[model samples]
Target: MARTGSGTGSGTLLCRRNIKLDSFLKRNTERAVYERIRTYEPCVVISETINKVYMHVVLSDERVYLTEYPPRALTIAFSFRRVRDIELVNDLPDFLSGKDRELCQHIRITYLTEKPAAKGRDWLRRDKREGLPPAAPPSRRNSHSPTIIRTSEGYPAHRVQGEGGTEEVHMLPPTRSASWPNPESLGLLKVPHPPARPPSKPPSLYSLSSSPSISPSPSDQRLNIGESAQVPRRMGSVLSRLLRRDGGSSREERQAELHLYAVSRTSRLYLHLQSSWNSYIIRSTLSLDPLYRRRCSVLSDSTPDKRLPSISLERTAHLFGQLSAELLQEEISVESLYLLLQELRTAAHRNVALRRLFWRSSEVCVFLVQTLEESLHGCQSLSGGYTADQLLLSTLIVQTLAVMFRETEVEAARHILLSAKKGALASRMLLALICDPELQTENQGSLADCELQALLADYLDAACSLLFEMLLLGQEASRCSPAENCVSIGWILRVIQPHPHLLDFLSYQAQHVVLVLSDLQESCLSPAQCVLLFQRCRLLLACLQYNSQLAQHLRSHFREEFRYSVKLSCAEEKLPLQYPISQPTLRLVEQILTLHRKLHTNTRALTSEKGL
Candidate 1:
């Protein structure tokens, strides 16, 4: 009996050792399987903290997993459906320092790109299918229960699942669950069906459910066994609609409610190191900005400089040609053109050399002239006048050109404009735009349409400024010959005679000229400066010869300033003239005075004729 007992003990010990070996092998097998799965999955190491805690970001086909390494205690999961945008940033945060600062690049992840799915009739139906108590029949259910309406085909229209060949439909009320009430109990009558017509298409399952015309009643409709068989045919269609509505959420709403997350610098470095550790395991999901990358590379290779990097002349010409081609073909959108012009304006405003380069392109110059002419005609076109976008675009174009011309040598700039093809047509268009009576009308429209009117005013101002610059150039060109000045002066006189608005524009310009003269008189003058003043005076006198009212207005308002400037200018040059005005200037002023007297005489004669 003792030997038998010892043998039993040895057998029990061997059995226990075998069980322990099996448990050890099972654990190792599970670990090996887990490691294999992780190797195939796409992973991104976000960061390793100073505490030696590592954060691992893993991207699956439809979800993202974030987990803490070592302890593996914390985990967060996100659905890809919620991801809106992913942006890579090179800028590091200021707070990070040392190893953490050197390790990571920034990544911005945007979420909540769509609205959350609402728990509606589908959810209730799902709950009922998943072992919940069956809902009572429509006839016996409380008034608070959803109403089930029947379609013409006698199928319940609500989105309820069929059980044992029985389908039920329930209507989704407008209000929340607690406030639900029978729509028919509110005294609503059943909607009459339209006249029966030939079936043009297969009937939709949700058609009766969504129809506002249908009203539920106490009478419950049950599908016959034959009708229940047809329910399966519509199930496919119903599920497809649901899937599409859920999966393809509207991007507009997502864009309106996007959220962004920026990973720290250390996290970025960790991601970089992790990617390098296993290139195939962790690949970038977002594309890098080529322009930004190129800029960074260039900066790193070159010496640091505070000044903004200058665009090459070749690049400027290429861009100008592209813009010109787009404008000529009318292929570019107004917004796109405006944006491009804005960039050009900013560049030209900052760099004088860029403006010079722009003018040197003959194609660009011609394009500018053509664009101005088209914009002017588009604004004034009687049928289908320019849209708000086009109006704003025209204003931007004019503003950009004005910026290019501003503070530059007037003679050179004018030469560039005149030398281009259709340049003369551009000037004529500017004059016509300034004289257009419609542009001078008071703003009259709803605030929505007022933007176009405001842009119209800005366009007119820009046009006037550009035209004045051109005229100044003309004045410079005609300085050597008084006769040459008549051609331009005569053209101006003829253009203004028919348009009182043009006369007003000239008067406004005359005020600016007087102010400039006043400023020049206060400062010591160079001979060249004195010559420019003389030319300005000559141009003003020529304009005054056209309108008696304008001439009188200038004389009354600026008589002292004008006289003082003339005397100062003549004295500075010591001109061979006793009169304050030079001979050419005096001749121009005398002609203006004669025109004013004749205008007065004509007015008096008209008044006498009316009295008779």
Candidate 2:
């Protein structure tokens, strides 16, 4: 009995071991099969956990696969060829109930008229070298000998004479084959056949010679000839299909579209997640703790990196589209609009390409004009309807426009601004903002909050800078057209007449001009800095030419500073100046001083006559 019991126990253990071994082998075989399949096919795998549910998504060239784990185990696959549309669902569907409905974010895919099953794994293996037939061996024939064979339809054919006097003939189709010249006419030698064992490296399409060759038979001698003939056809078909699949768009365009889609989706996800977290905190005990709130605020207010974030051209276009769409809506979120404008301002300031794109967008230009009009109306209202947020938003808009105009070519900027529907209205609104008594430098000290005062000052600076560009454009336009000169100059004169503070502000900006000119004389400056200084000088010259009183004010109050700046600018270079750029700047400064003196003298003479 003991012996029988031992034998039975040993058998049981053996059976268990066999079963475990079989299972292990099966798992490894499955893994190896999957890895082999993935080797030949390019795919993107994304692992995400949404609403406590883990999901895996696989994207292949032709199809999409989605798998959900655990309690809600589901797997779905669909081909891109069958997809009619893909929609991003922000709100919960009716079928999703309870917790699922509240937390789920899903993609809704619509299928075409006939939805077919996705292609098998073998489809991806088509490009593999192992799937291709081996190349045939070349026939043993005299180098000078040529044999011509004809098909039943009388079309010309090529014949390869093999060993044992067995001849194989390849018929050339009459229509397309005529384009290929006879091998003998080209004076080409026969290609050597591949060896019995296939080469480790795959054959390249370009390796095939242009001469006509025989098709392969069941025998190995003709294999290479067949492969060379078929490779070009197969490659051509593959490329055509890829081009068609992309719907005539280039690869770069498709990539840009995908990038924009990914960015928008990620932004939505982040916003949703942040909102959910905030709501959870509000419902929990953390909301009531002042210390926690303060800590959160401190973290939020921590200094960010000073370097600007890198942005692509596609992202800038996407931002412009979003802003235009939002502005077109009847009701827009102030915070969201401000954030978008802030991002655009940063992008425009950092990227010259983005600035040009921004200026070229006529829709954006019109929308900006409309926004300025609304802000102007609010500011001019009797009820004091312009809020701090509106002021900030306007400042961001002006700053972005100022950067665009400053960096872009003057003619392009002028043309774009004038082409907009309400272009002139923008200038009027800008003047109103710049001339607002509440935002004047003199009134800045009355504000208790220094930050608010600083913000107003920045807004004033941007407004003044943009207005100056517009005035330059108007001056050029005046030289060309008498009517435009009358309109632009008349409106500017009318606006300036009502607000003498505008002249004071111009005088204040002249201080910066003095400092920049003095710095230019003391040390070498970059070409860009020199250009900026030249622009400032031109603006000062225009101010002097336009108003004799302002020139008199400068001569009386700031005469010594002006004289010193002019003297420093005229002195021979201590440090070498960037030629051409700095030379023009120096010449402009001399012109400005000459004009200032002439205007100041004329004003004094006119004042003496008035006293008499």
| TM-scores of all candidate predictions against the true structure | 0.33, 0.40
**Residue lDDT tens for model 2, 198-272:** 324542211111110111112112222212222222333422232234333322211000000121111122222
Pairs of residues at least 3 apart in sequence or in different chains that clash in candidate 1: 103-269, 104-265, 104-268, 104-269, 105-268
Candidate 1 residues 75-168, lDDT tens each? 2133333434344445433334566444434443434423342232334343445332232212111211112233444433332211111122
Q: How does model 2 fare in lDDT?
A: 0.39
State the number of backbone clashes in model 1.
Answer: 5
Off by over 4 Å in 2: 1-319, 349-363, 370-391, 406-423, 436-448, 484-497, 514-535, 547-584, 604-612
What value does the lDDT take at residue 180 in candidate 2? 35
Root-mean-square deviation of every model: 33.9, 30.5
Model 2 lDDT at residue 374: 69
Q: What's the distance in Å from true for residue 139, model 2?
A: 84
Candidate 1, position 265, lDDT: 24
Q: Candidate 1, which segments miss by more than 4 Å at Cα?
A: 1-306, 311-315, 318-330, 379-387, 407-426, 432-445, 482-501, 504-542, 545-612
For each candidate, the alpha-carbon lDDT, in order, equals 0.37, 0.39
